[model samples]
Target: MHRPRFLSGAIAVAAASLLTSACTTGSGSSADGGGAGGAQGGATVRLALTSDVTTFDPIRQQAASDYVVGRLMYETLVGQDDGGAIVPRLAGTWEQTPIGVTFTLKKGVTCSDGKPLTASQVAASLTRYRTISAGAAMTFGPGNTGAGTTITGDDKAGTVSIELAAPWGELLPGLANSTTGVVCSPGLTAGDRLGTGAVAGAGTGPYELVGAERGSAYELKLRKGYDAWPQYAAMPAGRPAGTLRVSVVRNESTLANQLQTGAVDFGAFTGPDAARFGKGGFRVEAAPLIRNFVAFNQREGHPGADPKIRRAVAQAIDANAFNKVFGGTGQVMTSYVDAKAPCVSTDPSLLTKTDPAAAKETLEGVKIKLVGSNAVGQGAGNTYVQEALRAAGADVQLTNADNGTWATQVMGNQGDWDLTVFPMIYGQLARGGVHFIGDEPADGRNFGAVDNKAFLAGYGAATTTVDQKAKCAAWQKAQKALLQAGDVVPLATVNVHYVFREGVSATIPAGAFDPVTLRIAE
Candidate 1:
């Protein structure tokens, strides 16, 4: 089965969706004489994961679970702060040129193998990533994955330059994705082994993977001389733990209990268990996990192929009522992309409203196959969807499967479903355009077979400009077109809460934690 499509490009942007005590809250750096390693300091910071990572390769990571661990072991050229601003990572500084951007590598950067990192190596790694990521459903971030882009490096000048195929305004933000992590010579040569965790020394991040027990646990050790932390304007004053241990526990209750017992230092929770951490003096961070929505398989022979049926289905969904199903922990979404995305539609008039009378007249006796993923609280949400549709006189068949199987069936050529509740995590606004106007799934991301000419025109106009104002204006038009045609119906944005033990802290931006800002209070 293919990896689940949810959280395909898991980099998050800080917005109204993010709820935390502070953007940068930590204390103590390596230079503070605290020394390194859990043994030297106190005890290792333990993390809990709801699922095991799909792959160790940053380039192939498809789920949020992978990103949580992958970010520490792999370094990107740039990274996004809580406010979605681009920040330097491996590149100490950068400047935009006419065609693209140029970056200067930090002076003391080194790979896990203790070899110095060079601009030439970074260029080669980027080229490899572009070649491997072609025609894939997601590129981890926005902008084309260097399909026709040119990259060059000068080791003597300590510079790497990227010239895109076009004037894509979000190129820098796209580079912030962990998928662009530079692979060193050892990892580049390890081939498939590198992707499978069978090789080491291929990464240039702060931590290196040292041990793994498949579904049980994974261990990472901080590099001794690592000095490539991003220059955040403000942050807590401590360094990451010398040792980072990620434990995979499938049960949410078990994971929550462990946090209370002080067995785990950190864990992200989406369900009701999150409330337990709120009152315990644990540091908490909350951000939108995914935008829950529904889409029609507009291919011929499907009920959704008819415009009237599609409209009726859209009219039957009550976004506010759906939000309550998740215990009111989520925000109602106004567009295909979440509110965190730039230029999202804030006008409710553009969307279809709940009209039970009209929906009943149009959808009576209509047969519908409703598919959904069981991950996170999607099953309950899907149930809400099924009951609403049934009330409108549609014969709905609901199939809520495991995340992986659900993705394979929905995106495959099986034609097994008519409508689906899809929960998506977006990296850039342009990525959402791919879902509504692209080749069908198994080959492309548009599983719904959407064919809205207005949406296409608006999206095309947005891509032609690099100006933020013009681009966002065009995007507003594009999203309005999609909503009016009922191509995709957005429901709610779910929040994932990150809880840390009383004395532990880290800077979280866009919901993802910054490794360098981790601190344990003495």
Candidate 2:
């Protein structure tokens, strides 16, 4: 059966720019620390988090912390498995028509409050998110022209249909994003006062919010009747029979101590912690994520704008050296996008080898500034670049900022830095993802910019071409052309590692943590 298509090239490209965005939700919760929590089977799974979620409101949530909790409490229209295949959730099935896409809700789904999940509720939630979330607006919205989509609900038919004002290529993948979690009407304008009993956040997720203590901890209980995970038609005797207690174990020492004492069941580790956990008797589950890379500002007047200089820096930096600093947890990058992605280029030039001699000859007193965006937590990676550039006899300087500052200043500012570092969360096989380098939101983004013909041409076919096989081929060619241009240099593949004790196991996705599927080994 034909599935929903990806958005236009512009839609996917715009989405890529903000995937690592430092935008804040103002909920006042710190999410940058490690966590530990879980208990024995079917009792209570205790987790230590660096920070607890600030809000249960899905659309307004900006921190990864919020999604960890929100995802367990709410359900989206559809979801992807570990293999990246799209599966039905709240949406039983979907089909694309000339005007737009239509979705039929799964039968018998109900909210945590015991209200039936209605088509109108799902329809309103999608529209509300598009109106409130800037990121979602850019994805499903009209062509930068602001026309947007027309949405309608058929309660009797249990379906919702959406027609875009412009050419949209991917609808299912866009709606399946975490930001589009569906909720009842009352949830649309309700304040996110989670735990005060002021509002019981309603959704169709497996777990329900029992209560929470702001900044310290939160609790989740399996919904009595939630059967979303098909294997659990009749929940096993020990399944959906436990409470989840996630605490804010912010300090590294305390988190390590808790893991040793069995006070917590799981924790995500990086830097030294991951290496330490490897030998610390904990089972380390390493999931490959997109590599962090530097995008050289290729705009006119920028010192790195010259293609030759861009290639020079690409060959100077050592990808392995950057991974070594992360306690040997990362791998050298293989492509401009994540290696597992379909749209990634296979060109050998992508893995540019470090050549000090060549880089030195290419650079004659040419100095460039490298800006490190802390959103990806790869600050140490920037130092390696400075050392490599200096070794090649090129003058180099580094400026680092927390995500908030980096998001405000460097993301769109032209001629500010020769290089900037960030991660990629390529969606829809990176159809629009590979084309993000041009001026639009991807082009220095706050302005209108476009890419070369080869890149744009490939992206156009990949997104608009109806033949699926031909589309994939088009995306491959587009990515190759971009990598050959050397506008951006991918450094290394970073793994988001989760540490679990002997009795615990986790089912985390590539780019996200899945608290609901977290299980205690029998």
Candidate 3:
């Protein structure tokens, strides 16, 4: 099952009332004068993080934190290599026939608890996810409904057959994500602890969960006898050097201070923090993130439903100004698909450019309310948007609304607001756009409530078509429909930056946006 990023309105509300606290006041060391694991045989690696991870269960929470933890605890049947190719992990090899695809399970593998890993265990794990009662089931088709996936196993041949109702060309790449990680059979009956803030599972990875405290920290120990240990050939020493400790230290200054004082070995830094860290002797790395965009609410009668008003809003704001305030940290995206994506459109003619006069003419005499989060950088661009609309002769009011209430207001079309700002972390598969905007019964990610018939039909065609070139055309066409309808405004792609101490090293894998696998120099 695919999991989209989770956003809570309450989070926005909390951010609005957020007080900037002094995170670096105390000494860098813990009260014990050692990191969470204490000094091990060689050295200990303690990663001090800034954000509070919402949950540890991969199936329950789709947060980046969960993916970070999953990278240590579980191994998917297939995974994305550093080069972004779909590579084998737990399953040694796989092949597809007219009937279905068969995955050959790696021999002599076992979970953290020593339970033998088999075709049945893998099948059972998938079956449990398909039958999850609490969260939304992972779907491969329209309406976000499960496509009746059936996993059949052969103990004699040590293989698993995944039978889909129709041919799913993107199946392997999709399975490389945490949404399809193998779970222990016993853990399947225990219920998902995602919302409860607990981490309990027997997985097949190089590390085992030692403990986790909600909103605080999580500890992991190197797993012995792990069959997938060989997969870490690219990592330092081909294994985790020692036990790793990840702490939640949300303040960027505190994280930087800790890194300098040797209290923490690694963390992410951007914006002012990036500049500060670079001047303070820390190693910084930057990477291109999938495109980010602001969605428009297109539910019936919503202001965004008016083509003229939508076009006016889109044309008014200067993306260059938004990038300036955003700190030149990422590139500006013109299309829904990432620049690196196959079959992406590169024609400049299709891109959105600022046109204040055109925007004003389109929005002449229109009055609209703009709502956004008051958190730092959350709604920095909304100000520019408001200014542009006003320049176009539209009466625009800016309001600080709690993020929680923002979606409901948009969905219900109750608030006088005509626009709001939301950001998305696009995945490699490019399925997020289709799932959130094209699928119905409206998912949390699909805050716009866009219901374009042409887009839906195009999305259906893209998913059903097995040909790669044809599928890309269909997907691009679907995106065009949304853009032409003014259902969403393309925004700049935000760059993700990570900062760490000199001795710390990590292999940040591709495909999974989560940054995990940091190790201290041996």
Candidate 4:
């Protein structure tokens, strides 16, 4: 979960980028099929990326753009399908054990370096990943860290076991995240170089990084005889593009324009530019990208420390009105988790209905500071929020910073802001629990300094339970606690639109497209 710019799970304004790690919805394909194998499959598929990746190290990736490149270069042990159900990838099969999960490797899977992918290498990678100060591993168990996890590999048995110090129902789904991508020994040896895009053959996916031009484009070529494709039921029966030229086109209009001119085979858009290709011709796959919500800082001396003030701020704004800013292409959220996440609450009582009169009465004369990431069209939403609070008689100040600054100041808890319309794409409740249930930031990425006993209790139950019905019930309780306490306000879910040229198609899950699922006609 990096700084979300649309597809990632950090924070975003709208459907900002393309492809979530594994979850997506809707299907878009072309009837014009390409010839079989060789030249056709050998053809280069030019795709569009809204931003450039800061690193190639999957473990250290922090933005949606980074995932765009990482997904193509790395493969996870297990994968989630369109329905967010666990499916096999590098691991041929897996089973839940008392402590954690054990996975048996698929015999033929090889690293990009053309060597056998050993369970020892996978175990070592996971071991190293757990030690990294920040990244998905921290959230994989939702909050468990190095002190609470262990990994072991048995090459003779072709198995790898991940044992958690505590019960975590999300162990499988967490491993499916792009950030948990298993790296080869070469990649682990590369160390810091992995973060700078200087290492190759560190991944176990279909493509290998061959060239990179920062802020411009990345070049990758398909691995010959690569056969570890995830057997997603809806995957188009076609070969992967022989070559991938991922061009960085930061503008939505430019990405849409490129799709129409045959300059790029595929690109995702979440703004007005999406309307340009909806009438036919281009293939389109759409999915709710991320759930945008309102979160308040509860640090002492802050306006948000009082639940009444937080509720008043929540009531001042309308989720429907906010959704309209993105052309009403998203669903109004009823809980902190996105609609796609398992155990997400659908209880309408969890939200406070718009009541400007009550809000104005409570918030009048209150001074507040609002912060947001300037990525995509987030500023427009920030302006709307500013005006809403101002109209409520509160002296509101809004600051829109670049994704980096916002993540550092706001997400890193270095700023003095009171509230934010935060957006994220975490695919599971447990995967995102770290944000709502701890005392300090180090405990659970609780940047707001939230201290909710009820929320933590509910979260504990949900993560500890293996029963689906019980888990969902516990999750609902957790969400209710957050909403009722005014700790977080659910808003809406923005949809990411993947528009593709004819003869090329891809499946979109949840927030983003799976690069391995990409199919191009020869």
Best by TM-score: 4
Q: Per-residue CA lDDT of candidate 2, range 397-479, in tens?
A: 88776655665445546336777765544534443353353454433352213255677677666655445577678977776
- Per-candidate TM-scores read 0.86, 0.83, 0.81, 0.87
* Candidate 1 lDDT, 126-245, residue by residue in tens: 888877854221332234454657778899999998876655566666777777778887887887887778356688887788899888878777777677776554555444566667
Clashing pairs counted in every model:
6, 22, 5, 11
Cα lDDT of candidate 2 equals 0.59
Runs of candidate 2 exceeding 4 Å displacement: 2-41, 97-99, 141-147, 189-198, 230-238, 279-281, 349-351, 374-378, 425-450, 465-468
Q: What are the candidates' C-alpha RMSDs?
A: 6.2, 7.4, 6.8, 5.8
Candidate 1 shows a clash count of: 6
Stretches of candidate 4 off by over 4 Å are 1-42, 136-144, 193-201, 212-215, 376-378, 442-444
Better of 1 and 3 by TM-score: 1
The clash number for model 2 is 22
TM-score of model 3 vs. true structure? 0.81
**Per-residue lDDT over 1-522 for candidate 3, one digit per residue giving the tens place of the 0 to 100 score:** 121111103232212111111111221222111111222222445644445556545555444455566656767777665533445577877875422468887777777677788788888877666666233232333233365567877877888888777655556656676656677665666564533433344666656667777677766666544545323324432123345566765677776565667666565654465666665656666654434555665657667777777777888876667667678777666666455555455555655567888887788888777876544366666676677778889888887665556645654445655677654444443455553443333344455667777777666676665567787888778767767776667667555566656655555454222233444443
The per-model lDDT (C-alpha) reads: 0.71, 0.59, 0.57, 0.73
